[model samples]
Target: MKRYLATSAALALASGSAMASGLDRTGQPIGIIFEEGTYAEFSVATSSVDLSGNDRATTTVGSPGNPFQSATGDVGDRFNMFGAGYKRDINEQLSFAVIFDQPWGVDVNYPVGSSLLLGGTTAVADSNAITALLRYRFNENFSVHGGIRYQEIDGEINLAGGAYASIPGGTYNIRVDKDGAFGWVAGVAYEIPEIALRAALTYSSEITHNFTTFESYTAGGAATTTETKTPQSVNLDFQTGIAADTLLFANVRWAEHSVTDLIPENFGGRDLIDLDDSFTYTLGVGRKFNENWSGSLAVIYADVDGDNLVSPLAPTHGYEAIRLGVQYTQDKMKISAGIRYTRLGDAIAAPGGAVGVANFRDNDAVSFGLKVGYSF
Candidate 1:
C-alpha cells in the first residue's frame, strides 16, 4: 500500500512539470529522486509566453522619444523540451541513478516588425545536464544521496533595427558555445513507511562555463571569448499521507542569482540579463482512485526580487500558477499528463534609459506535459 501510494504521488509531480514560473525554464524538481526499484521515465513539455509591449527608442542616445516609429503586439516565443531518468537498486540498502535535464536556459526574440527599437533583437541560451547519483539507505527511515553533474551551455545574441545605429557597426551580434562544467549535489532524506511520509533537502553547486565565442558589430567584425555560470540552488521537498489514499506535498526552491554576474566584456560590459535572487514555492494534494488511477492539483508561486529596472531580455517579473495532473497505471508502467496556467506579474522594461515602456502586467502563459515511466 505504501509503495503504490508513493508511486502515485511521484507520478503526480512528474506530470506537474508542465510549466515553471519566472525566468525559470527548468523547475529543478526532485520528484524523481525518490523512485523505488529499477525504474526509468521520459518526459516532454512545452510553454508559450505572450511577452509584448512597446519599443522605447530615442532619436539619439540622449534625445527624446519618437512617437511615430512605435510598434506594439505580442513578441514572445514558444519553447519545447524533453528529459529522461533511470534508477537501479543495487541491493536493499544501495542504489544508483542517472538523470538528464536542460537545467538553465533562455530564449528571447523580438518580432522583426514589432518595433524599430527592438525589431530583430534576439537572444537564446541552450543547455543540457547529466547527473549520476548514488544513494544509501541506513535503516527503515533515514538515507543519504549525493551526485555529480556535467552541463554545457551555448548561446547567441543579435541587436539590430533603428535603436543600434550608433555602435561600431550599427549593430551587435555575439555567440558563445561553452564547454561542460562540473557540479555536485548532496542531500539527506527521512522516510516513514508507517505513515507514508518523506522529506528531503537537496543542494546543487554552481556550474560555470567558459564559452569559446565569436562577436561582430558589422560585416567585418571579429569574434570574442567569455565565461559565465548558472546560479547554485537549493530545494526542499516534502510529502505526507493525511487521509486514506490521499497525499499532501510541498516544495520550496531558492537560487542565488542576485550575486552572479553574466556580463561579457564584448557586450559593452553591461549586464545583458540577470535576476534578483529567485524563490519558488509549491503546494499540492494527490488522491489515488483504485489501483490504476490517480490525480492531483497544485499551486505554484515565485517572487520577482531585487531591483525593478527590468531588462527587455527577461521581461516578466513574478508569477502565480495553477496546475492539474492525472496518471494511469497498468502492471509495471505508468503514464501521466498535465496542464498549467500562469499569471505573470507586472513590471517596467526599458533599455538605454532614454525611452521605456511600463505596464508589463496581466501577462499569462499556458503549458502542457507528458511523462512515461516503467519499472523492472
Candidate 2:
C-alpha cells in the first residue's frame, strides 16, 4: 500500500499543471524526503496549449463606426519542464534530500498581422530553482523538516496594439536579466506506517529579485532596474490507505500573489500585471492490480475570483483538469507515466486593467510526463 501511494503521488507531480494559477508550475513539493532508504529520480513534462481569442469590437480605438473584429490567433505556446531529486537517510531518525525543478513560468505569443489590436505581442518568463532539506523524525509518528532554496529567473516582453497607442509606434518592449535569490521552507508531518497514512503541511517564503531591465519603443530605449517578488505559498498534503492495495490522496495549495508585483522603472513604475491570491485543490486514488502494476486517477481545480478582467500577457483565468497514470516496478527500478487534459476558464484580456479589449474562451491544454526512479 505504501508503494502504491508513492507511485501515484509521483505520477501526479510529474504530470504537472497547465496554466496553473499565479505562475505556479511545480507546487514546490518536498515529498522525496519521505521516501524509504536512499532513492533518486528524474522526470520531464511537456504541454501544448490551444489558447486564442478575438479583439473586442467596442474597445478598438479609432474604429468607432467600423468595429474592428479580428481573431487573436493562438497566443499560448508549447513548453517543457524538467526535474530531479535525490534523498538519503543518514540513520533511523535523520534524512536529507536535494531537489531541482523549474518552479514558475509564462509563455505567450500572439500571431503577427492577424489581429490589428494585439498583433506581434509576445511575453516569456522562465525560472529554475534548487532546494536542500533536512528532516528529523521525533518519534514513530512525528517529524519536522526545513530547507533553503535558491532560485533564478528572467524574462522578456513585447507589446503591440491600439491599446498601447500611447507608446511610440504603438509598440513597447522590455527585457529582464536573470536574477537569483534565496528563500526558506519549513514543514511538519505525521505518519502511521501501520495504515499507510501521512499528513504534511508546508510553508514557503517569498523570494525577492532585483533585475536589470531594458525598455524600448520606436524612438529609443532606456535601461533601469526592476524589483519583483515571487509569492509565498502553503501546501497541505494528506494520504491514507482506504482498502487493500488501495490508497487515497488529496492536496490543497494557497498562494499569496497580491504582494508579488512587477514595476519596471522605465515603464512609469506601473505594475505590468495585477494578480490576485489563488487556491488549488487536488484529489486522487491509486490501486495496485498486482505486484508489478498500479494505476491512478486524479482531478484538479484552481479557483478564480469573480472578476474576468486579466492581463493580456497572462490571459487565461483558473482551470479544471483530470489526469490518468500508470506505474511499473521491478526489483529496485520503477517507471511512471501520466497524462492530463485541462480546460481553461474564459477570460477578458484587459491591458492595464481596462476591460473588453479581447475575449478568450474555449481554450484548453494537454500535457504528458514520464519519470524513472531507483531505490537502494
Candidate 3:
C-alpha cells in the first residue's frame, strides 16, 4: 500500500550532500516526519569526487604562468558523511521528531606534487546539526510543525603554492575552532491519508556563529575574532501514492548561500570564502514489489549561479545527479542501500589574470549509502 516509506533509501543516497553547491555537505531533510507510527533510522554515505584540470597558461602575465604544463592530474578528493533520526506520534493530532545531520562542509585537497599553481593547497570544513520538531494537526487536511535547532562548525584552510607565495609567510593557515549557534524552523502541511498525498513547505532560520580565527604564517601567527551566519533556506516537499504499489515524490530547496561569507581580518575584511545562492530540486518514484521489498529511483538537479575564481579549495560548479535505491523490510527492521552518480559542471578554474589555471571539465562523483530503521 504505502510503499513510499522506501523514500528513506533515496534519501540516504543524498546524505553525501557534503558535495553539494557552495561547500554544502548536507541536504538536512525533514522527511522523517513523514513516517507513520514510531520509527528510527540511521545512515552513512561516502562520495568520491574527481575534479581536476590542465594548465591553460600559454604565456606568463602577472604570475599567471605558475601551473607550467598544459596538462595536469586530479585534484578533487573524497569524503564521507553520516545522519540519523527518530520520529513518533504523540497522539492522534500530534507528532514529535529528533533529527541529526551534518548540514554543511568542505573538503578539497590538491596534490603536493601537482601543477605549481595549486599544488600543496587544501581546505577542510565540518559541521553538525541537531533538531527537535513538533507537529500538530488541527484537522485532517491541515497541520503545522516548528522546531529549535543547534549547530556546530569548525574548519581549517591552507593557502599556499602559486599566488600565495608572494605573501609574507608564503603560506597562510587559517583555522577556526569549534563554535555553536542556534536557529529555528517552521512549516505547514496538508495531507490526505486515503491516497497518501501530502504537500509541505518549510523555512529554516539563519544561525550566526563567532569563532576565534587563527592565521598562521611560516614564521608567526595572529588571531582575531570573527562572525559568520549559516544560510537560511526554504523547502517544498510533496509526495503521493499514484497506484496500487507506486508513488511519486518531489523536493524543491533554495538556500541563501551567498550570505555565508567567511571573511578574515588579514584579507582586508573581504570574503576569504564567498559563495553564490543555490536552488536544487529532486524528483523520484517508488514502488513496492512484494511484502518485504521496495525500491526507488530519483534524479537531482541544481543551478549554481555565481562567479567563481580559480582556487584549489573550490572546484567545479553545478551538477546533475542520479540515485537508485532499494529497501528490504523484514520483521521489525527496515534496511536500505543506495548509490548515486553525479556529473559535475565544467568551468574556468579562475575568472581572470590568475595563471596556470585550466578549465575544470568532466568532473564527476560516485556516492554509496546504507541505512537501517526500526519501528515499534
Off by over 4 Å in 2: 65-67
Q: lDDT of each model, Cα atoms only?
A: 0.74, 0.87, 0.77
Worst 10 residues of 3 by lDDT: 58-67
- The model with the greater lDDT, 1 or 2, is 2
TM-score of each: 0.92, 0.97, 0.92
Number of the top-ranking candidate, with TM-score as the measure: 2
What is the per-residue lDDT of model 1 for residues 1-376, given as tens digits with 9 covering 90 to 100?
4765556555555544433433457765555657877898998888887776665545653466545535445656778777888989889999988988887667778777766666787878777888899888999799999989998887887877666666676678878776788999999999988777888899888877777777777656665567676778898888889988888888888887754455666666766665667788889888888788888889889876765556666777777888888888899999888888888767666554334443365678888888899988
- Shift in Å, residue 38, candidate 1: 0.6
Across residues 138-241, which tens digit of lDDT does each residue of candidate 3 receive?
A: 99889999999999999998876554556676677889999999999999999887787889999999899999899888778789887898889998988888
Clash pairs (backbone) in predicted model 3: 17-25, 18-25, 64-355, 310-349, 310-350
Clashing pairs in 1: 215-223
lDDT of 2 by residue, 201-285 (tens): 9999999999999999888899988889999999999999999988898999999877778887767666786777889999999
